[model samples]
Target: MEMLRRWLAAGLWAGTLLVPVHAEEPSVEAGLRVSRIGGCHDCHTQGFAETGGQIDPSMALKGSPVGFMGPWGTTYPTNLLLTVEPMSEDAFLDFAKTLETRPPMPWFNLHYMTEFELRSLFRYIKSLGEPGEPAPEYLAPGETPKTPWIVFAPPQMPE
Candidate 1:
């Protein structure tokens, strides 16, 4: 009994010595939920809104050809996969906090998300595999876009 106890103790100690400590793996499922409810798919995924939110998982976050035009100019939904491809989790969190985009993008929302949520989101985007093609370049104010775009003029107020 004594010999067995000693052997077990040594084995446990050896196991602990070999185990590497790392941060918990970010939850991809949580990230997916965030993507859906956060309106990411509505813009970033081509045809997502038009198709009534039934986009294939394979084509998600690849960006859209459609642009949102306003007084600030025209902007396209960026390929989120490519946007974060080069960023580490920390960098992504920092970028999210400071993001400021034109017109339609809800950039302010990122600033309010917790670090865990952001990390999970980053992991989820990265897990989608290879990045998709880049979106069209930004068109300055008054410049017409070659692709289809939605105009964002203010609604006429009733006098």
Candidate 2:
């Protein structure tokens, strides 16, 4: 009877201890969920739910070769699928905290996420494992891109 009681107690203790661990570690579904909510696909891939475009699961997280031009210059989203390809998760997390990406990246949007969410995002992107060409180099104002990825039209002014 005493042996049984000890086993039960250990089981209960372990159960309680593991809850936070499981919560902190995102499952595949959870990671994917947060990625959508975080709008990661908008810039990283060609089509995403947020832009009213169809989802292309096969092309997920491959960085955009296209460029976004603005007064700040032309910027392209990094290949998030490779978030951890060059570094460990710990290192990626550190880099994320101080991420100063170019325009339209919305890195600032990520600064407030919990570590769990960030890790989940990292895990989700890592799951993709598809490497894309690095984003085109930044073009300063007045500099012309060698291969213009996108053409712009003059913004319409309200009469």
Candidate 3:
């Protein structure tokens, strides 16, 4: 009986050694969790943010059609999946760090997050598999937008 137990253990060990170990894909769930907490779905999901709905399946990370107008310019969120599809993780992180975003983008939030968080988010977005429509072009303060837009109030100057 002891010899049989030893043989079984050796067999299992040898079998495990023969099998190829595959690395698990990065976690989409982790990316989704971070995205939800970070509000990536907000402006990225067309019409969803303003309506206060949860992330829309059709519009997920596809960017809003609406534009936000401020003194600096009128800006639209980019389709995240489409934008990041061509970029490596390192390139994306570098771009995120130095992004010169316009108003209402909350670009500052990205500055506070870690690289691992960004990687997870990117991995999940990449896994979505298809690209979305490109976002509207940014318009300077006085330029006309191709679509309708909401102009924000000017900053209040201190007394």
Q: Is candidate 2 or candidate 3 better by TM-score?
A: 3
TM-score of each: 0.81, 0.71, 0.74
* Cα error of candidate 3 at position 104, Å: 1.9
RMSD of each: 7.2, 6.0, 6.9
lDDT of 1 by residue, 68-139 (tens): 998889999999999998999999999999999886999999899878789889988998988968999999
Q: Residue 144 deviation, candidate 3, in Å?
A: 2.2
Question: Across residues 59-94, which tens digit of lDDT does each residue of candidate 2 receive?
Answer: 687767677777777777776765568877777778
- From the highest TM-score down, the ranking of the candidates is 1, 3, 2
* Error of model 3, residue 132, in angstroms: 2.1
Off by over 4 Å in 2: 1-24, 49-53, 146-159
Candidate 1 local accuracy as lDDT? 0.88
Error of 3 at 75 (Å): 0.5
- The alpha-carbon lDDT assigned to residue 32 of candidate 2 equals 80
Per-residue lDDT of model 3, residues 1-159, tens digit only: 999999999999998886754333446787888888998887787766667767667778887768998887899888898889889989988877877677798998888777777887888788776786888988888898988888897778999
Q: What is the lDDT of candidate 3?
A: 0.82
Q: Higher-TM-score candidate among 1 and 2?
A: 1
